[model samples]
Target: MSATSKKILVVNRKSPYGGLRSREAIDTLLVASAYGLQVSALYLDDGVFQLIQSQQADQINSKNIARMISAFEMYDLKEVYVDASSMGKRGIQQQDFVIPVEILTTEQIKTLLHQQDQILSF
Candidate 1:
């Protein structure tokens, strides 16, 4: 990584398809990666739904964020994460998520936040 490569954490806290925040966050992730920053996404609250599988956005006439997420690897935007507490509260199993996510405990989330050089919350 270059010295200019910042460790950024993009936090998503809104519901998927409810508004443009989720889409904006994903856009930021891709742009940051293209700029050579070390980017990761931390999904919490209703944002976890953004990772759920088999979303039919066409029916709602919305761009499919789920499909966008599956392409994160191609953009070199890895290290996707989720809050364990959020998942449990929503009754979402790890396998239920469309993309692979590193489910983190509260303590781990704290540590991650501390380690990041920049935080962009959506």
Candidate 2:
């Protein structure tokens, strides 16, 4: 099937800073979704930090990505899934996220990833 006909999941695992992986993942998600792909985001490990509010990217000379993330809705992106285990490990609560998210258990995450037609990791 074509890309627009398939489900695409963007899996992000990098910290919001110290690298561009998180930014790249968001960029890719926006572009893919703009093309009419069925896109979703799964923030695992440090990736969950990408949704944290009041980030100090400027402290490190890195540009903020909050705006890009907030654009998910305009692009009609699917659900934003956060790993429950990861959040607990990092002491991050659902309220800590700038945008709303659906929490998923490890097993559920596995099933979700398994069901995706395309998996893009960063």
Candidate 3:
């Protein structure tokens, strides 16, 4: 992108089910990317659950977030990330996720946020 383009970061901190925040976060990322914005997504706490492979949203009568997440690459929405502490606390590994993500420590996430011109949390 150009130097004038703002770097946007979308932080997902909610569960995919029982709410719409997680899905909204993904939608935001896709929309931003479609507009040619520099976009990245960071999943923390329960939000990391969205990346779990083979989600069964049918049980909750909700749209499968995995399907939306799977379209990330097609939209050029790269730079997906997860917090290391959260992963350890929840006993989740990279293999447990639907797609490869760059794992970050709390400090690294802070640095990432600092580098962004905008941050949207859901």
**Model 2 steric clash total:** 0
TM-score of each model, paired residue for residue:
0.94, 0.95, 0.94
Model 2: lDDT of residue 64: 80
Candidate 2: worst-modelled 10 consecutive residues by lDDT: 59-68
Full-model lDDT, candidate 3: 0.90
Q: lDDT scores for all predictions?
A: 0.92, 0.89, 0.90
lDDT of 1 by residue, 1-122 (tens): 56457689999999889999999999999888888878899999999999998788999999889998888989977799999999999999999888889999999999999999989999
Query: How do the residues 12-94 of candidate 2 rate in per-residue lDDT, one tens digit apiece?
Result: 99888858888899999999888888889999998988998778888888888765798888888858999999999999999
Q: How accurate is candidate 2 locally (lDDT)?
A: 0.89
Please report how far candidate 1 places residue 88 from its true position, in Å. Answer: 0.7
Task: Write candidate 3's Cα lDDT for 1-122 as tens digits.
Answer: 57439998999988889588888898899988998899999999999999998799888788989888989999988799999999999998899888779999999999999999989999
Question: Could you tally the backbone clashes for each prediction?
Answer: 0, 0, 0
Candidate 3 clashing pairs, residues 3+ apart or interchain: none
Residue 43 in candidate 1, Cα distance off native in Å: 0.3
TM-score of 1: 0.94
Instruction: Give me the runs in candidate 1 sitting further than 4 Å from their true place.
Output: 1-3
Q: What is candidate 2's TM-score against the reference?
A: 0.95
